[model samples]
Target: MTPFWKLSAAGFAATAIAYGPARMGFGLFLPEFRSVFSISLQAAGFISSLGFFGFFVGLLISQFLTARRGPRPPIVLGLAAATTGMSLVAVASNLTVLSLGVLLAMLSAGFSWTPFSDAINRQVEERLRPVSLSLVSTGTGLGIVAAGAAALLMSIGGVSWRLCWALFAVGSAFALLCNWIALSGAGEASGVRRPLRWQALFRRATTPIFAIGLCYGVTSTVYISFAADRIAQAGGVPGLPANLSGSLVFICYGAFGLLGLVTGQIKTLTGLPWLLRLLLLASALSSVLIALAPASWAGVVVSAGLQGINVMMTSAVLAFWSDRLFPAFPSRGFTAVLLAVATGSVLGPVAAGSFASHFGVTAMFLATAALAASAALAIRSGYISETPHPE
Candidate 1:
């Protein structure tokens, strides 16, 4: 494989482990976490909320780390954190240790994503940026698959959540090694260290992009943190899936989400603006299906497929759009995108979790649908500007 292709491979490993298992995997196994800790719905939501906050912190640090040094170190650090953190979660006996493990794993997401994007961008020709990024986004789908497979394995072997997490940590170690080999020296910054310009980073022209980020952030998190839980709920106990088992729903979601790898092709046909709008609509439609008929296998299958498509499409759009708007500072543009995403990460679980705890999971999905609809309106209203094209 070419060097850029190698970078893509490393990125896939990093993202799969960091975002997929370290971050998204938490929701997949929230039932186990709650059972072990004897926590309430509110508590599980709060724990996920904390993970997002850690994600925010990691984003902030990534801004500096990628800016000064390069992608490899931050990627390495993030993967290491994931390796250690998930292991902690695996072995923890109390709430405090479990919380710490969760925090570290989420924080690893911050470190892995942006830096690697920088690395990938650096490795590829300009024409290939969107395609490359889309390839990396697919890693999340792969990672989710890994997590789901682990869940399936757990079911087959009667493995404990703790044991699964330990296995995840081992997987992270492999990811870290993949990154080290692929990005070492290849991704390190070369020129004089330049500070991120706040003015450019927060310019008025990019407002619409930020708005898209916000909409995506809120909607995606609600789904990521709760989608499986909803599936499980429909499948069993008060908050747990006592029926089809957690792995089945997650495998469906992960498998369908792989559609995002084609985001570059969609962008090529529709352009960034329309693509965002369309995907947001897709998200809304998926949310409604799930909210209206959580237990329906048809609804669940379609919902997972749609959610998977939009989730990857949204990320590819943001990266592609940023390339069009701020070619000089991809990292900062990504930071803005992630900041909105991470901000939503904070709000999504809290709102969804609390709503689910009080009213029902369906109510939370309805709220998410509303969020997606508003985002589509924002796009239609020119919140992003009238056909932004890079010079």
Candidate 2:
């Protein structure tokens, strides 16, 4: 196989394990976790927030590592963390162990994704870089599909949820091995080690990227952390078994999320700014749909499909956009964008929990929709330039 093909496969596997089973599984399995741990809804939200905070910590470590070392080390460490973390969750006998496992698993996501920006920048031909990045991100959809399938099977077979996590751990280990081999000779940068410049992160050129990241982060993570729980609480899809209904929505999410593979073409045709605006509109629609019809099988499934596309497409846009913005240090610039994402993710669930407590989950969803709509309008008003700024 060619180098691009190899990178695509490895990057796909890396993202699949990191984002799907490791980071996203917590939300997918939140209902089970809450029941088993005897935790309240508020407590569950807090744990989700803590996991996002851990993601932030991983991003910080990865930014410096990718700058000093190469993409491979952080990528490898991230997969390893996913493997170890999922293993712990598989056998957790108490809430503390489960929380620690979740933290480590989510942290892997921060480390796993951004390094690919640097890797593609250095390894792929410039003409193929955006397509390659989109291909890599589409792995998250596949991962979600696989996890949802496993969950559906578990429900049918009366298998334990722990077994599901064990399977996730095993898959993570496989991804780790694939990335380690595929990234051979892809390590250790030759450069002066220095602190990431605050100025670079705060530049006018990057303002829209940061703002988009923050808004999308809040909207996306809140939905991920609680959507299933809300659906499950609403008694799930009418025709399906209660346990299977929630899982089915994610399968739709992953299936539609595969649409992310076409993101490069879409961006080429529509331009990045327009693409971002459309995606934010989709997100707002998704949040509002779920809030309005959490129990409707068609409604929640459609919401997941919209969210799936938004999640995958936005990730690809951010990767290439940051690469465009900071060619000399793609990972470093991407790190700043991801940090903004992580910040919003950390804030999202906590604030959402408060909203859910004071009002209801419906209120939380409506509020997130409003935030997404406001951000989309801001972009429409030319708060962000229509094209990438000149380097």
Clashing pairs in 2: none
By TM-score, the best candidate is 2
Q: Candidate 2 lDDT, tens digit per residue, 1-391?
A: 6668888889999988988878888888888887899877787888898999989999998877887888899999999999999999999999999999999999899899888877876788899987787778878898889998899899889999899999999999999998998888575775766565657556676788888999888999999998888888878878777556668767888899898778879999998778988999999999998888877978988899999999888987887777677765555677888899999999999889878988998988999999998888778445555344443
C-alpha local distance difference test of each model: 0.78, 0.85
lDDT tens readout by residue for model 1, 225-332: 777666666664234345334565567778887776677787779866688878999899989987887776677778877887888767767776776677766667
Clash pairs detected, candidate 1: none
TM-score for all predictions? Answer: 0.90, 0.93
Q: After superposition, how far is residue 80 of candidate 1 from its true place, in Å?
A: 0.8
Candidate 1 wrong stretches, greater than 4 Å: 121-134, 236-244, 386-391
